[model samples]
Target: MLIRLAIRDVVLIEALDLDFSAGLGALTGETGAGKSILLDSLGLALGARADSGLVRHGADRAVVTASFDVSEDSVVTGLLADNGLEGEPGEPLIVRRIVKADGGSRASINDQPVSAALLRELGTRLVEIHGQHDDRGLLNARGHRALLDAFGRFDTGPIATTHARWRAAEAALEAARADIETAERDREWLDHAVAELRQLAPEAGEEETLAADRAAMQKGARLAEDLGHVTTHLDGSDGALAGLRQAARRLDRIAHEHEALATALAALDRAVIEASEAEDALAEAGRAMAFEPERLDAIETRLFDLRGIARKHRVQPDQLAALAEELEARLSRIEAGGAGLAALERAVAAARTDYEREAAALSDARAGAALRLDKAVAGELAPLKLDAARFRTAIERLPEAQWGADGRDRVEFLISTNPGAPFAPLVKIASGGELSRFILALKVALAEAAGARTMIFDEIDRGVGGAVASAIGDRLARLSTKAQLLVVTHSPQVAARADRQLLIAKSHDGTVTRTGVRLLDEGERREEIARMLSGAEVTDEARAQAGKLLAA
Candidate 1:
C-alpha cells in the first residue's frame, strides 16, 4: 500500500509531504484547489512525461517521490528484486522522479538510478488509477483474457505447449516438402552424374602414381641406346668376359711349371668368374630396360581421361571419389524423404489434434467464467443506480486466421444502457457517470485478484448525489477492505464515509497562491462537508445535515 507522497516545486505545490494510511481515504476541495496537480505529481513519480511547465516559476526542478510498503513476497518487491533495486529489509520502497526546468527527467528507486521504463513497470504492480480517460487495467481489452483466465483458475500452460508443438511440426513439414521438391527437380541431373562417376571410378592418389610412372618410362625410353651399349660391353663378342676367359686358360696351363705362376693363375680364375656374373646381370638389365609403347599408351590414356573428368566437374582428380560419395548421399536422402513425408504428415495432424483439444477445453472454461462474471457484475448494478443497464462479458470465437497461442476467443466488456438498445463496447456506450459506476462494480467483483496494492479513483462520484453517492461511498469503502483506495471526489457523502479525510485548499500569501493538503479533524470535516452541501454558504442547517450524514 502507498505509505507516503512528497512533492516539491510541482505546479502549485511547494515542499509538500503527505503520509497515507491503509483503507479508504478521500481528497475533497473546491474546484481549482489543485487536486489534479497532486495526482499529476503522483503520476510523475510513476513515470509520466515531464513538462517544464509543471515546475514552480522560481524553482530549477520539480521532484515527486512516492513510497510504498510492500510484503517481501509481493509483486512490487519481486519487481524490485528482478531489477536489482532491492532495498534494506523492512524498509519502504521509494520511487523518486526529478523533472528539471529544461524538460529533462531522471528516475530512481530506493536511491538507485533506474530507467523510466522500469519505474513504469513498477507502477503497474503498485498502483492502478482509474478515471474517465484512463486506459490501464480493465479498460484495455487486451488484459481481459488473462483476467478471465485468472478468474477461472484455468491453466493455459498445456494449450501453449501443444500450440508450440503444432507449430514446430508445421515448420518441419514445410522444410521437408521444400527439400523434396528441390531434389525432385534435380533428379535427372543427379542420376546422370552418378552413372558417369561410377564408370570413371577414380581412386585416391592414382593420378600422382600414374604421372610418376609415365615420367620414369619416358626418361628410360630416352636412355635406351645408352643402356644397350652397357649390356654389349659386358656380353657382346670380344667383350671383357671373353678376353678374361682366354687369359685364365693361359695362366692355368703354366701353373705346374712354377709356384709364382700358380698364384697368378688363381687371381686370373677369380677375375674370369666375376666377369661372367657381371655379363649375366647386364643381360637381365637389358631385358628390363626394353620399353613397351603399349604400356605407356595405356597409362597416358587413363591419366588424360581422369584429368578431363576432374576438369568437367571442377574438382581435383583425387577428389572425384569424394564427390561421387556426396552425390550418392544426397540421392539417398531424397528417397528417404519420400518415405518420411507420410510419417511427418501424420505427426502434423496429431499435433494439431492435441492443440485443438486443449484449446477447446480452455475456451469452454472461459465461457463458464464469463457467465459467472456477468452475473456478479449484474448484482452490483442495482445498488449503483444502474439496474436498468446490462453489463456483459462478451466472448466471441475468433476466425482461424486470427487464432493465437492465448486461445481462440476475443473477450470484451459490453453494455446496453437502455431497453431495446443495442449492446456496444462499454467505453463507447456508457456515459461518464455510468462508466465510473460500472468500473466500480467490476472492481468490486475482481478485488480479490486485482493484484494491485493501491487503487485511486478520480471523481468516481461525479454527477451523482444523494443515495447514489452514498452507495458509491459504500462500494469504495468496501473496496478499501481488499486494497488501499484513494478517491478524489466532491461528494460530501463519500468524504463523510472515509476512514481518513484530507482537504485540498489554496492559501494566498500575497505574493503567491500555494496549494496544500491538511488532515481534517471531525469539526473541520463537518465544516468542509457543510460547505459542499450548501455551496458558498456554511449554514447551521447544512452543518446539522453534515453531522447526520457523518453519523449515518
Candidate 2:
C-alpha cells in the first residue's frame, strides 16, 4: 500500500509531502484545483514518461518519490528482489524519479539506480491507476488472460511445464535431423577415411619407436666400415690375441732361467687372456649393431606413410587411432539413422500431445471462468447506474501462431451500453464517465484477484449524483476493504464516504500560483463536502446534508 508521496517542483506543486493511510482516501476540490496534478506527480514517481513541462518555472528539475509498505510475498517485493535491489524486509519500498527540465529522467528503487522501464514494470505491480484514459492495468487487453486466470484461481504451471517439454523435444528433433543430414552428405568421405585409417593402423607410440630405430640404424651404417676394421684387429688369427699368446708361450719356456723372466712370463699370459675377452666383446657389439639395408628402407617408408596420413586428417600421428574410432562411430550412426530419428519423432509427438491436452483443458476452464466473471460484473453494473449496460468476459480462440504458455485464448472485457447494441471493447464503447464506471465494476468483480495493492480512480464519480454517486461511493468503499483506494472526485457523496479526505486547492501570491494539499479534520471535511454539495459556497443545508452523509 502507498504510504507517502513526496513531490517537488512539479508544475504548481513546488513542494508537497502527503501521508497516505489505509482504506479509501478521497481527493476533493473545485475544478482546476490541482487534483490531476497530484495524480500526475504520483504517476511520474510510478515511472510514467517524463515531461519537461511538468517542471515548475525557473526550477531545474522535478522529483517525485512514492513510498509503499509491501508484504514479503507481494509482487513488488519479488520484482525488487529480481533486480538485486534489496532492503530491510519490512521497510517501505521507495521508488523515486527525477525529471530534468530537458525532459530526461532518472529512476531509483530503494536508493539503487534502475532503468525507467523496470520502474514502470514494478509500478504496474505496486499500484494500478484506473481511469477513463487508463491504458495500463485492467484495460490493457494484453493482460486480460492473466486477469481471467487470476480470477479463476487457475494453476497454469502444469500446462506451462508441458509446453516447455514439447518445445524442447521439438528442438532436439530438429538438431538431430540437421546433424544426420550433414553426416549423410559426408557419408562417402567418412567411409574412405575409416578404411584408410584402419589399413594404416597407427599406434600411439609407433612413430617414436620407428624414428628411434631409424636413427640408430643410420648411425650404425656410418660406423660400419670402421667397426669392421677394429673387429679384424681384435679377433683375426694374425691380430693382437694371437700375438700375445705366442709371446706368453716363448716366455714360459725360459721362466726357470731367472726370476725376472718368470714374472714377465706370468704378465704375458694375463695379457693374452684379456686380449681374447676384448675380441669376443667386439664380435658381439658388431652383431648387435647390424641392420639390413632393406630394413632401413622399409622403416622410412612406414614413417612417411604415418606422417602423410596424420597431415591429411589434421591430427598428430598419435591421434590417428582415435580418429579412426570416431569415423567408425559416425558410420555406425548413419547406418542406424532411421531408428534414432524415428525415436526422436515419437518423443516430439508424445510431448506435443501432452501439451495440447493440458492447454485444451485450460481453455475449457477459462471459458467457465469467463462466464462466472461476466455474471459477477453484471451484478455490480446496475448499482453503479449501469443497468442498461451489459458487461462481458469475451474469450476468443487465438490462432496457432499466437498460442503460448498461457494457453490458446485471448481474453478481453467487452461492454454494450444499450440492450440491442453489440458488445464492444470497454474503452471504445463507453463515454469517459461510463468507461470509469465499467472499470470500477470490473475491478470490484475481480476483487482480491485485481493484482495491485493500491488502486487510484480519476474522477470515477464524474457525471453522476444522487443515489448513483452514493452507490459508487459505497462500492469504492467496498473496494477499499481489499486494497488501498485513492479517488479524485468532486462528488460530496464520494468524498463523504472516504475514511480520510484530502483537500487540493490552488492559491496565488500575485507573482506566483501554487497548489497544495491538506489532510482534512472532521469539521474541515464537513465544510469541504458542503462546498462540494453547494456551488462557490458552503450553505447551512449543504452542511447538514454533509453531516448526515458522514454520519451514515
Candidate 3:
C-alpha cells in the first residue's frame, strides 16, 4: 500500500506530505483545490514524464516522493533486489523523483539512484494509477493478455517450461541442419584431402631425421675421394711400411754380431711397428667413409618434399601428423552426415511431439480457467453497474508456427456493452466510463489471483455517479478486504465509503498559495463530501445526506 506521498515545489504544491493507510482512502476538495496536482505529483514519482511547466513559478525544481509498504516476497521487492537496492522484509519502499525547470528528471529507489525507465518498470508492478484519460491501467491492448491470464488464474509454469523445451529443441535442430549443410558443401574437398594425406603417410619428425641423414651422407661423399687417396698411398705396391719392416727384420737377425747394431735395429723395428699401425687405422677410416650417391639423393628428395608440404600447410614438419588426423576426422563426419541428419530429425520430431502434448494440456487447463473466470467476473459485473455488459475471456488457438512463451493460445478480454451489440475487443467496444467499470470489476474478480499487496485506483469513478458511484464504492470496499486500496475520487458516494478520508486543499500564505492534505475527521469528512455533492453551496440537505451516507 502506498504509505506516504510528499510533494515539494510541484506547481501549486509548495510543500505537502500526505500519509496513507490501508483500505479505500478518498481525496476530495473543490474543483481547483489542487486535487489533480496531487495526483500528477504522485504520477511523477511513479516515473511519469516530467514537464517544466509543472515546476512552481518561483522554484527551480519540483520533487515527489512516494513510499509503499509491501510484503517481503512482493514482486516489487524482488525488482529492488535485482537492481541491488537494499530493503528489509516488510519495509517501506520509497520512490523519489526530482524534476527540474529545464524538463530534466532524476529518480531513485530506496535512496539508490536509478534510471527513469527502471523506475517506470518497477512502478507498474507496485502501483496502477488509472484516470479518465490514462488508458494505461486496463484499456491498453498490450496488457490484455496478462489481464486475461490473471483473470483466468492460469498457471504459467508448465507453459513456460514447455516453451523453453520447444525452443531448445528448435535451436538444436537448426544447429544440426547447419552442420549438415556445411559438411555437405565441403564433402568433396575433405575426401580428396584425406586420401592424399593417407597416401603421403606423413610422420612427426621424419623431415628432421631425413635431413640429418642427407647432410651426413653428403659430407661423407665429399671426404670419400680423400679417404681413398690416403688408403692407396699407404697400402700401394711400393709402400714404405713394407720396405721398413723387411729392413728391420734383416737388422734384427744380425743384431747378435754387434751390440751397437742390435740397439739401432730395435729402434728401427719400433718405427716399422708405428707405421704399420698408422696404415691399419687409415684403412678403417676409408671403409667408414664409403657412401652411395644414390641413397644420398633419395634422402635429400624426401626431406625437401616433407619441408615443402609442411610449408604449404603452414605448420611445422612435426605438426603434419596431427593435421592429417584432424582432416581425417572431418572426412569421417562428412561420411556420416546422412546418418547424423536422420538421427537429428528423429530427435526433432520427438521434441515437437513432447512440446505439442504439453501445450495441449496447458491449453486445456487455460480453457477451464477461462470459463471459471468468466463466471467470476460476471458475478462482479452486476455489483459494478455492468449487469448488461458481457465479459468474455476469449482463448483462441494461435498458429503452431507462431507459438511463443505463452503457449499456442492468444487470450484477450472481449466485451459487448449493449444488448444485440456485437462482442468486440474490450478496448474497441467499451466507452471510457464502461472501461473504467469493467477494469474495476476485473480487478475485484482477480484481486486474490493477482498476488498484489496493494491496488490503487485513481478516479476510477470518474464518469459515473448516483447508484453506479455507490456500486463502484461497494466493490472497492470488497476489494480492500483482499488488498489495500487508495482511491482518489470526486464522487460523494465513493468518498463516503472510505475507511479514511483525506481532503486535499490549498492554503494561501499572502504572496503564494500552497497545497496540503489532511486526514478528515468524521465531521470534516461530511463537510468535504457535502462540498463534493453540492459544489460551491453546501446545502443543508446535502450535509444531512452525507451524514446518512457515512453512517451507512
What TM-score goes with each of the models? 0.74, 0.87, 0.79
For each of the candidates, give the backbone clash count.
0, 0, 0
lDDT comparing candidate 3 with the true structure = 0.80
Candidate 2: Cα lDDT at 12 = 96
Model 2 — which ten-residue stretch has the worst lDDT?
71-80
Better of 2 and 3 by lDDT: 2
Which one is best on lDDT? 2
Global lDDT scores for all candidate models? 0.88, 0.89, 0.80
In model 2, residue pairs whose N, Cα or C atoms come closer than 3 Å (at least 3 residues apart or on different chains), thus clashing, are: none
Error of 1 at 318 (Å): 11
Please say which candidate is ahead in lDDT: 1 or 2: 2
Report the candidate with higher TM-score, 1 versus 2: 2
For candidate 2, report its TM-score. Answer: 0.87
In model 1, residue pairs whose N, Cα or C atoms come closer than 3 Å (at least 3 residues apart or on different chains), thus clashing, are none
Once fitted onto the true fold, the runs of candidate 2 whose alpha carbons sit more than 4 angstroms away are: 205-209, 212-296
Number of colliding residue pairs in model 2: 0
